[model samples]
Target: MTSLAPSGHLTIGEHQLEYRMIGPSPAEGPTLVLLHEGLGCVGLWGDFPDRLAAATGADVFVYSRAGYGGSSPVQLPRPVDYMHREALDVLPRVLDAIGFRRGLLIGHSDGASIAAIYAGGVPDHRVRGVSLIAPHFIVEDTSVQSIAEIKTAYETTELRTKLAKWHKDVDNAFYGWNDAWLDPAFRAWDISDHLAYIRVPMQIVQGADDQYGTLKQIEIAEAECYCPVEALVIPGAGHSPHREAAEATLRAVAEFADRILNGHGEAAHGQAA
Candidate 1:
């Protein structure tokens, strides 16, 4: 699959987000937005989104948030509202600036949660659907422990050095995400309350062995969400199902998007058949 060379920059309020667009031209097909994991940027997503867009025939848009990639970097000691800032304020701006009204969202880790928040807030039925990989509403102790382990490994092993190549400000991005997540204040961060408002068709893809979240997260979202939800638990896969089982995850998302776009899938649960 060919890598994407996306034009960057979409302004939101006073801030500009750096973005890339891939796949078939946005004019020819449905657009699918790709949201990266906590420590990810356009570079880290590599060629997966390109392959996915090819398979689905959807134009793909990807970006780095403030302080992550080429976008304007935030000074250190940023507030916890940072994630909220991206989800509530930044995402819409990017979509609107690019003139994509209806599109599929493919998000991983923190990005998945952001997609959920976006889907819930927009009242318009203009959104075609969303696909979540390793999403979370409430942070779990298991996640914390796993994160602790990662931090330890980063210090003791080569993980930090390896990750440094992918991030422009690697420590800034890593600690900015890590410290806030491990903070006690973050445990209370739950978006399950907003699930009922999301009416777009969605697919939740989780790894059975995901170290960051439990299956309860998926169960809660599916139960609370008004939209038709499909859950896929890939056995033996960990946090990054798309990375670990790209073919399977891509197939599931492709079929799900096809169903929704073709009007063959149920929209909200119990509203119709």
Candidate 2:
């Protein structure tokens, strides 16, 4: 895959966030800000964000959170409140710096969790919609099992080394991600209460074979959210649908963005099964 163009950086609060701007020259085509997964950085997205922006004629803003990729490294260990910081503090500042008055949120894995919180915190006018790929609500046996498998691979194979090349400070990125999920307080974590507060349209894309999140996580969000929601479970896909099934992921996001921009008034998408 071709590399994304050099990304721009903004000094949001104490840290400088590394963000890439791709697609049409203007920010007019309904911006879709991509939130990366755990252990993911702007480089980790490969070509999918560019593909999605190209497919939908939308400007996409893909960024690496603090301590990941080219962003400012984390000086201290990530606190339990880190996710809260991203949602409540960092995201708003990013939007303001980019002059993002309104846009859709496309988040995968941990990014999805952060999007839910950020969207929930803001009023409807600030957000157009949200689309989630392989999202999680709370940690599950399945989730833990998957993490264990990843740990095994990291310990016994070259996965750790491979990932380290992309991250300047891989230990900070890896431990910050792994430890946060494994933390005891994270187990009781549930975003359902915040879901009700999001008035914008929402879509969730999960893989039937996703090792991290069970179907119940998506189901609960669909059932509880006050606004219109659509869920799609792609067969044979796994935890990272954007990588495992990039074409379909881009298509779904394009359709969702189209619906929102065209003034569909209500959410509409093919159902999940």
Candidate 3:
């Protein structure tokens, strides 16, 4: 993978976000915008961005949201609409700040749901496709249970210590997501209606053993989305398929990007079962 240093500080409103751009420029092809998971930051992505750039030959852009990594700090107890705000408002500004020409959104977990919302809410022609990994369309008991367990681990185990190394304000980052999900009002949160508005091709990657969500998320995409949808269910993998099954995840994403973004004709409208 080609080495490219992160370009620091893109101010999206009152906050400054840390971001990195790798591989070719927008002039070369559509950029791949990576949205990290609930507890994730740009640094937490490890070498995946580099490997993805190597695999897809498209520019890879990654950033740490407020309070994560080296990005500007945000207050604790974030609003329930945090994900929706990020997708509907902040993400578009980030893209514009970077001068994104055309792109694909590759999002994981919480990030994936944000991408789904963005694609559906925004009528941006630049978004050519979306690749979701372990995305949640609606709140579930399993998801709530898993998040509650993680909160316990954060307080009791070495999880906080480990995460502290990645986030500037670990509590802000942790509680922002935790409190919102655990809030009773968040139970009504769902993005399934947004799927019907998504017109770009989509690829869904999920771990069969994902503790946070189920195939119901993918089923919603297949059922509601008018765009072509492809699904990849990896066995023996859990929540983070890109981490647990790197090669397979990378190949699937790269191939999808090639077919949808670099192909000669419009993507076919069908479901890949």
Candidate 4:
């Protein structure tokens, strides 16, 4: 495995992606790779990575995709198939770049979808399980409506200014995700087909009141996946259960990682303080 700095930039193709490695390295133990939600970057995740690492005992890897955080900029009006491209093209390179040996993918929203696409589409044996929080297997009317509303907030409120702190190219980060979802053709965007291909056990977490998606996403995973599937629904939370319900979310993710990685129900790794 490559020697990783605590935090630094990784050159993957044309982009220099910003990343953080918390706790143990891949060579030391199992790894948990975090895929952030749309409009999210390394900074937005705050201390969640360190907390997750402590809870799971496995190393936690977090990175900002192109155009997010301090990473390189990407073309505007991102392709509707952008998630697919990231799953099939960029994420593989990232895993290889980090010398990932064996690990699980823990993704939120867009990142969740990307992980599903990668695990389902790619036959990489290194990925042992997938945990999705507020994932979308298919585009929902709620998703489109929420995205449109956020765009309005970005223009009319301080949302852009707040996000600007994390993204070097805020508009690129915002519209790349915003414009693609709003595109009429994107309504047909669905990756539930990917569910049928996943071979590993799966864990899914969602808020009871996630504005971006609904329980239907969970139903879709249960209906299509042949692998073992488990889910957690955090009440009074929104799209980001990890933020809105941090402690519960951390415990769930930690337990799932421990059980799947160690072949037991108990957490084999020591919790970080």
- N/CA/C clash count, model 4: 1
Assess each prediction's global lDDT (C-alpha) against the native: 0.78, 0.79, 0.88, 0.91
Expressed as tens digits, the lDDT of each residue in 150-207 for candidate 4 is: 9999999999999998899999999999999999999999999999999998888899
Please, what are the lDDT tens digits per residue for candidate 1 over residues 1-273?
123346667666765567778854454567888888888887788778788777776788888777676666667766665666777888877776676756788899989988888888766565778898899877789999988788888788899888888777777777887887877787788888878988887788888899999999888987898887888888878999888888887777777776766655432221101
Q: Give candidate 1 misplaced runs (Cα > 4 Å).
A: 1-5, 13-16, 24-28, 263-273
Identify the runs in model 4 with alpha carbons over 4 angstroms from their true place.
266-273
* Candidate 3, residue 75: how far the Cα is off, in Å: 1.7
Going through the candidates in the order shown, the clash numbers are: 0, 0, 0, 1
Q: What would the per-residue lDDT of candidate 2 be over residues 1-273, giving only the tens digit for each residue?
A: 122344777787777778788854323446788999989999999988788777766778889999998888886656766776898888887777776755788899989988988888766475789998887766798897788678778778998899888888887888788777777777787777888888887889988889898898887887779988888888778999888877777677778877786654344455432
lDDT of 3 by residue, 32-59 (tens): 9999999999999999989998877789
The TM-score between candidate 2 and the true structure equals 0.91
Report the number of the highest-TM-score candidate: 4
| Poorest 10 consecutive residues by lDDT, candidate 1 | 264-273
Q: Residue 37 of candidate 4: its Cα lDDT?
A: 94
State the TM-score for model 3: 0.93
- The order by descending lDDT is 4, 3, 2, 1
Which ranges in model 3 have alpha carbons more than 4 Å from their true place? Answer: 1-5, 264-273
Which of candidates 2 and 3 reaches a greater TM-score? 3
Indicate the worst ten consecutive residues by lDDT in candidate 2: 264-273
Steric clash pairs (candidate 4): 54-272
